[model samples]
Target: MEFSASKRIIHGFAPAFALLLLGSLAAAQSPKKSDYLENIALCNGPGHTSLAARIGGCTAFIDSGQGTKTALAIAYNNRGNAHTINGDVDRALLDFDKSIKLDPTYAKAFNNRGGAYLRKGEYDLALQALDEAIRLKPNYGRAFVNRAGVFLKKHEYDRAARDYDEAIRLEPNLEAAWSGRCWTRAIIGSLQAALEDCNKVLQSWPNDAATYDSRGLIHLKIGEAAAAIDDFSAALRVDPKLASAFYGRGLAKLRSGDKAGGDADISAAKAIQSGVDDDFVRYGVRADN
Candidate 1:
């Protein structure tokens, strides 16, 4: 099973030129107008903005009481995104609910809500929200990917694979979709296809630890212990605390006749995540093998 979290889909602002135009408008207007424009800009800025700043900006825009209903809904959604990133899932859910109440058709809000639910381990609620998001916007690749994550957590590999397939079909360049599909296919014993998917992600995002871990599992499944060790080591280099990588590398080490190293790695993995061995067992890998 894939141990990575689902990618959160947040709404972005318009082009920089639009912000420049807003700046010009603010310059020609009252200080109140300038403050509103600045607030909106800070609220909708990209991921570079600090979570606290983004939340403050969104709150300023929301409390100003000067925006249209649609704009207010967007502000709520943006604030919810910030809250989600800040690890305040409950607050994020409240903001998402407000956004949905204001704009019932806001697919991004639903998608984000589903991501929050996924973080909270509320699989049923996550599925409901993602299902609505996909229903509202059938072309929503991110929603499909998030839904696939729920399926993965539920151990529904086939359903997860189907969702990942639709997500890749809708957005071929989505790295999360490819990485997720790789993990799903790996668990389902489709080694070659899973390797292809992992290769595609690594080609674009070499630093992705989850993809490296997925590829490591594939190599382990195919009895390429050396390659599996290399891949798992690479994953551990990227994220040292990744229990799956440690556990997988342990298995590879054991297969390669390094009993001491294997035992140490397995111990470390268990220290990081007590259930790591069980996850490997579900993936059809075993220390006894």
Candidate 2:
């Protein structure tokens, strides 16, 4: 379960939150043409699976061109991030190791390497990497959030909650931190607290389909069928491509005696992706499609 939580944190880093941060940064820095070239070079991944190869290729280009050490570091770091996203923990760690070797004080490289360790279930290694990141940059809210997620996985609920509290105090607008708090609360059986954290996340990101899905799960836990259905429906409305919303809503519908609707939702979920868990089909609720 702890490992699962860590996986969730690494695989789903709240894209909306990252996008929002990027938007804010865009206004402050009009990067040069060289920056654009560097970005393209860093984006040289092939099919997203062999990120290590892509990193090597990008670094080769950086070496050939009189690209600065910063550009090479960025390439290594971005490749490591891609490898981490692709679940190649060892390769991700290697790339991050290279990035840090090039720029020893690179906080992001340490933080990302920590995430790779977290995914590999190397809790102590993850902590060490995150500790280095924090030492390098004291205001790194992301490291705090990741560390808190590690604690949550360990079921050290008090410590997890404290870390989450500190992270939120440091960065009030980090949606992932709020979502992490929600997941932690849910695990600890504090459904109300979990729901509250979900609500806060949704307030900042109303179109976030996952938030609605999570809130629906909380409602289902609390036996609020109608509320759960509403959340599931909202999630589907936001992102029609999501199979989980249909499955969740189907379960709610099944609970409410809407067999036809429930069946349709289940079918829709299966149509989108045939691999949805049978448990999801059996237990999920929704209105007739």
Top candidate (lDDT): 1
Prediction RMSDs, each to the true structure: 2.9, 8.4
Error of 2 at 132 (Å): 2.8
Q: TM per model? A: 0.93, 0.65
- Kindly provide the TM-score of model 1 when superposed on the true structure, using C-alpha atoms: 0.93
Query: On residues 1-289, what C-alpha lDDT tens digit does candidate 2 reach at each position?
Result: 1124333454212121112222223422545445544434444453443655555555554454434556556566777777777667798788788888988988888888888888887888888988898899888888888888677556577777777778798888887778777756755668898899999988888886777887887787677889989999998888787787787788788888888998898789889877665434233322332
| Residue 254 error, candidate 2, Å | 4.2
Q: How far is candidate 2 from the true structure (C-alpha RMSD, Å)?
A: 8.4
lDDT of 1: 0.85
Q: What range of 10 consecutive residues in model 1 has the weakest lDDT sum?
A: 12-21
TM-score of candidate 2 to 2 decimals: 0.65
